[model samples]
Target: MRQLPKLSFWQIWNISFGFLGVQFGFALQNANASRILSNLGADLHHLPLFWLAAPIMGLIVQPIVGHVSDRTWNRLGRRLPYILGGALVSMLAMFMMPNASMVVAWMAPVLFGAIIFALMDGSFNVTFQPFRALVADMLPDEQRNVGYSIQSFLINAGAVIGSILPYVLTNMMGVSNEAPDGQVPQSVIWSFYIGGAILIISVLVTVFKTKEYPPAEFNEYKNISEAEQQEKQSFWVTLRSMPKTMVQLAVVQFFAWFALYLMWVYTTPAVAQHFWHTPVGDAGSAQYNEAGNWVGIIFGAYSLFAALFSIAMPWLAKQWGRKTVYALALLAGCLGFVSMYFLTNPNHLIVSMIGIGIAWAAILSMPFAILSSALPAKKMGIYMGIFNFTIAGPQIISGLLGGTILKTFFDGQAIYILIVAGVSMLLGAIAVYFVDDIHAKSH
Candidate 1:
């Protein structure tokens, strides 16, 4: 086995640049999926049920893509094939998601939108899970933090653009925010159209620019023994022998993803009810649409903060260690979620977003930085795929229980959902304290 060479900054950048577009599409989805679903006749409580498609698809798709890509080798490259394929499908999904009313008339728009949501997220998981392994595949141990932080930066930067595109179209270009009954707005539609284009182009850049090593060389660089390569490893076998770091990190990931799922599904309705004063089930109203666009603005603001915060992650990890930095970052986000309860002004939401963004930066980079060092190189993809279980599993639980929790415990006040999400994040922060980073840095 040989030590892998340190990747140049541009090489690292090209490898991760596609994530910008991936997150861009995701940002648009996060900001507007609920709005689109509600416009198509989904109730507030039903939002979680409809949102279930994302994690369900991730739970099903990521591990399969990871396991397959691990064994695959072709001219298109192992990860790039999946990356390109997923991006193409995601682009098409994005193009059609906002236009659900016109996608098919036989099915209701809400149902159609959920289907698109699943397709988009499924494709995203396919691309996303591989990129994590690719970093471990390409970089030496020392460069892992820098590599994943750059990924975090691109992810958030794309998110900023994606989140605010609709707002920019509506306010800057004078496009309509409000649509005809049961239809998506022109501004939102165009945002998806533009986001789709960016998604494919950015992925193409990564596909062409980044060169994956061939099997002989990769096996040598990664120290994959011939015997290990020849052995057929089932997903369950991989799961059972998974690293201790993976299991420890799963506890942290579960709470973090569960909290995020709550926020993504509930934030729009929460804003509308708490500040915009729109009546329940009035997703079609002008004020409700305005609130939806505002959701975009604030979501973009958080992405902006996350981008800036990601720039400092490597340095932070160096000074404080990955686990400590991760815990502190989640703590910031937990406090941010708690702050949302007292936010009377829509503008003040940006303050809360800053904390959330700080948390987002760590969530994107640190765990992977920690976990990648601990995973076996040959099974990196499959292990990374299995890791999605932690991320997807909790969100699945959140989706199943969130609506009922909202209706049963909170009596339909969406703001309380954010508060509950805060508690979940706080738990994540505490859970982080328990994880052992195998290659941890310290003061």
Candidate 2:
């Protein structure tokens, strides 16, 4: 039997706290960047391309990080080194992103911003892969669910604060909301600085305070035969021969992420154009900041519901099984997306988001758990990295297609993009029914 050292609840909390900071960066990006692009004179049709850097970077970085980290086991620990390094780089990107329009012209600003954002986004994933593995390393399988749940809670908690920061700063701090056309507001700039600082500090807290299990413990369950581990195939060969299950999950992931990309890309515009009844780029417009605040409220509703639903999921899983629970969540999300077509009032958006949030929680936790159970312990890092390719790859595909859909089918009506996305998610939910969860358990 492999003996694992016990981690107390607080110790687990301390180790995972950095994710709160990371989510702060992600929340700000997801909730507001498209709106910021519009403020900075980006064409509505071109906005999806501006978000492309993140997915492209993720595709390249995650695998390399996993490959390298698998071969490393240093004194400060293999994962912690990447965690600290990535956080510092991401902090720099966070500080520079809001200032991009200040320095350059037209798409130049966004081009430069995307470059930095891509770097930071990729680095963050580097740290993220190993960190989850670290939990599996330190905790017994029974405690695994609790460890991941804490991480999920922190992710949502951080999102709430990050989502609300722009509203808080604009309303309470008297920060200047106005900027030269094609520039981010002063309040948003300050939010990035604060977020960057928190990013570094939160990760550092974990690095200084938490100790990793040694290599012996990490490899105790990793005693596969050398012949089994030997590679007759190259990277391209393995890539070509990717497991059928992985390919199936990728299809499901593609639709799931595409829908989410649509939501993140167009929520503000959907609110501003459809619900708030306002045109873009009008300052004294009641819809301008109101749209921004409602974005926060909508995001807060989804994230808060995600947090709540994550807690309820274990119970649901017990009663109906994970696939059934996931199917119900996706069905709810489809209904929520369909409802957006009818949403005239801003308050109703929150109700729609509650449905989406249930799906979001399942998206974050369940797929990975299912995938992790199937992968070999030695290749967990690589397989997880490959799993992330599904995420980034779909986002890239969505970025390309979402823009086209918004421009052509929707007639620049971003809400219809969500309708398409909702249908996509429904397809993803249906695909989950075919996955072999029985094999996952036997493994």
lDDT of model 1 at position 121: 89
Error of 2 at 323 (Å): 1.8
lDDT of 2 by residue, 171-240 (tens): 9998876677667888778878888888888888888887876666666655545565554445576577
Best by lDDT: 1
lDDT string, candidate 1, 1-443, tens digits: 58788889999999999999999999999999999888888888888888889988988998899899998999988888999999999999999898889855599888888888999989999889888888889999999999999999999999999999999998889998888888989998999999999999999999999999999999999888899889896667778999998999999999999999999999998899899987766788888899999999999999999999899989888887888889999999999999999979989999999999999999999989999988888888888988989989999999999999998998888889999999999999999988988778522
Instruction: Provide TM-scores for the models.
Output: 0.98, 0.92
Inter-residue clash pairs, candidate 2: none
lDDT for every model?
0.91, 0.75
- Candidate 1: TM-score? 0.98
Q: How many backbone clashes does every candidate have?
A: 0, 0
Model 2, TM vs. native: 0.92
